[model samples]
Target: MMNIVQMGLGPIGQQLTRYLAEREGISIVGGIDPDPNKIGNDLGEHAGLQKIGVEIAPDLDSVALLDKADVAVITTLSSLKKVSPQIIEAAGHGLDIVSTCEELSHPWQTQPEVAKRIDEHCRKQAVSCLGTGVNPGFLMDYLPSVLTSVCQKIDKVKVERIQDAEPRRKPFRDKIGIGLTEAEFKAKRDSIRHVGVEESVRMIADAMNWQLSDVEETLELVKADRDLKNDRIDVDKGQVSGVKQVGRGYRDGKEVITLVFKAAAGVTHSHDTINISGTPTFTSTIDGGINGDIATSAITVNAICSVREAGAGLKTMLDIQVPAYFDEASP
Candidate 1:
């Protein structure tokens, strides 16, 4: 069995613990969280799995269980300043790592030196290192590559992700500014805007050897005129409604690829689609938008698989074969 040291106890971290706990050949060995309130809590309960019999530990240092676990999974925010050291520290201790932070999936464009350092550390320790997630790693990079196998001459790539979901986290929901009028939203758009998935486009461009000259981003948020209540939350109908944001990448003034993110509680349309322009214009769509937390869980777990199979080096989703998903009752 491979022991997993889970870092971070936020929504994504909680879901990762729960989902990974269900899989075989994996065990939650220890956890690290800076939140004083969460320290020493039951890991299972922290993940809303009180019945699962795992407890959260108050340890913040990775060196404590570095010898016990084969790998570590980081589900922190995309801030490099905070996560880079954590990764290097883990690699230095001989633990393979999988992280959800952005840019790690496309280190060449975002942080080549950090990526190289992590690779060197992992190599010195004889371990593997990798980063992945739903958008940057899978949908834009790996999925597009899978589609290209059938294309004779690929011209352009377009990936659109539409997620009509509600934010259960209070801070993130407020950051989205759902109830603001078009004018108000426009007024504070830059400050209030959440980071979109543009790096995914660059990762794809790099993998396909496409020379990208420019990248542009835009947002279109639809406000709720009244209060609303649903599985995620009960908000004043007019508090800030729905949100739609798009990030596009261009090569020589031509849009080569793009990603669209949309979220709302009582909204319509929730799916992911990628269109490839080539000899036969191939288009593929997945029916559901991976729940942010669940998607993060899937990403971390997928990265773990890659780290185990890959040699001591730095890898992204482009380095592995995309796993196949089969509905158990499909027959």
Candidate 2:
């Protein structure tokens, strides 16, 4: 069985642990979380499951089972700088890592120095490390890149995601500024930067080996046309419902890649669309949109075997083979 250590017992982390527990050849050896309330609690209980005997440790150093772990699934903060220490500690103990940190998904474009340091450290430790999730890691980047494999020649690519935030978690709704006024939204927008569009754009450009002259990103408020009420919050008409974020990549005076994310509380339809203006001009749309929280946890859990198979180095979604559902009955 694959001995796994779970880091961060937040919503996504809890979901990931639950999924991992259901897999046949997997064992939850330990858990790491700094939350005092969660410390000493059974990981299964934190995940709303029957106690599985693994307790949450306040820190990685305190986990006696660290040396026995084959992999560490980290679902902590998004910043590479903040999450670097946790990743380093895991890799130091000779454990492969699969994390849901968005920026770490493709840090080469925005944080080359930090990426190099982490890559070198992981390589020295002889453990593979990957950062991934549903948006930056898949729908906006990896999935779009996979679609382009059929094209003989590619000119431009555009991906658009429209999501209704009403059904999402409170953190997600808050992150998108669901119920803020126009002035309030602008104030928090700079602080709460949208995590993944730029990374997705860079990942696409790097995959195609296109030399982008510039990558531009812009965020604007999505106002509510009428009053809106959701489980979390309410918004008056003309107030901020959410946001529209766009990232564009240009190469030699031409825009080659474009990604647009529109998420709000009252959106009529929630879907993902990809348009490739290349040979055969392909366009595809996903009917309902991928659920960010659930899909993120599923992808992180599904990536475990892939990370183990890809030995000893810093890995990305593009570096390893595509992942699939972990069949509990598989031999």
Candidate 3:
């Protein structure tokens, strides 16, 4: 059995711990969180699991106490600046790593220097590193690769990830600018405000060796005649409506695909799908909000599983199997 250390104890980290704790051949040796309140807390309690004898610590300085696990799953998201410390720490401890940091997903693209440093650190410690998550790692990149199996000549490829925002976490809800007016959304569209998913599209294009094209983005807000939030919350008309935002990926100056990501306090329907064209057009869709937190957790755990099975270097979701859910007590 391989012992593991997972960094970050936030929402995604908590879910990842639950999933990691379930593997028959994997043992969660320890966890790290920057939150002082969470430090020294029982891991099971943090995840609302019955006490299982593991506690969350403030840092991995206690690696010796934890027996120095064979691998580390890093999910902290404060900033790329803050996350670099965690990666350095894990590498210094001689533990292989799988991280959920955004820039790290396609490190070779957006942050080559950071990526190189991570690789150097891992190599110096004689360990490996992998960065992955939903958009940058799987849905956009690997999923597109899977579609190629049936196609002969690929003309265009598009991947769409649509989510209902009302149910998303508060931080993400605000980041998505859910209830804002269309103008308000556009006002913030300058360089400082744009999210990095475009990099994911670029990464996909690079991976597929697709020729250069243009990338365009559009954000839309749909106001409900009545105020609506989640499945539970409801309010009167015009208080604050829903929103629909689209992030598109294009090739050769033509709109090949678009990702419609939506969020609202209340909404009815939501789904995510990917469309590809070649000899035979192929499309695959997944249900629900993509649940960034849950998806990140599952993706991290799946990366860990892959690390054990596949000898590592820099890796992606295409380098491993899609995650599967399992109960900790199943055995």
lDDT of 2 by residue, 94-210 (tens): 989999989999889799988898899999999899999998899999998989999999999999999988888787888888878888877887765569789899999888888
TM per prediction? 0.85, 0.97, 0.82
For each of the candidates, the C-alpha root-mean-square deviation to the true structure, in angstroms, is: 4.1, 1.4, 3.7
Superposition-based RMSD of candidate 3 using all C-alpha atoms, in angstroms: 3.7
Query: Compared to the true structure, candidate 2 yields what TM-score?
Result: 0.97
* lDDT against the true structure, each candidate: 0.71, 0.88, 0.66
Residue 47 displacement in candidate 3 (angstroms): 1.2
- Clashing residue pairs, candidate 2? none
Model 3 regions lying over 4 Å from their true place: 178-196, 213-222, 229-245, 248-252, 255-257, 287-292, 309-312, 320-331
lDDT of 1 by residue, 246-331 (tens): 77888899887877766665666677888999888978888875665556567677557657767887777777555333122110
Per-residue accuracy of model 3 over 70-92 as CA lDDT, tens digit each: 88888777345568878888778
Top candidate (lDDT): 2
Clashes of each: 14, 0, 6
**Alpha-carbon lDDT of model 2:** 0.88
lDDT of 1: 0.71
Name the runs in model 1 displaced over 4 angstroms.
50-55, 60-64, 167-175, 179-196, 225-227, 234-239, 321-331
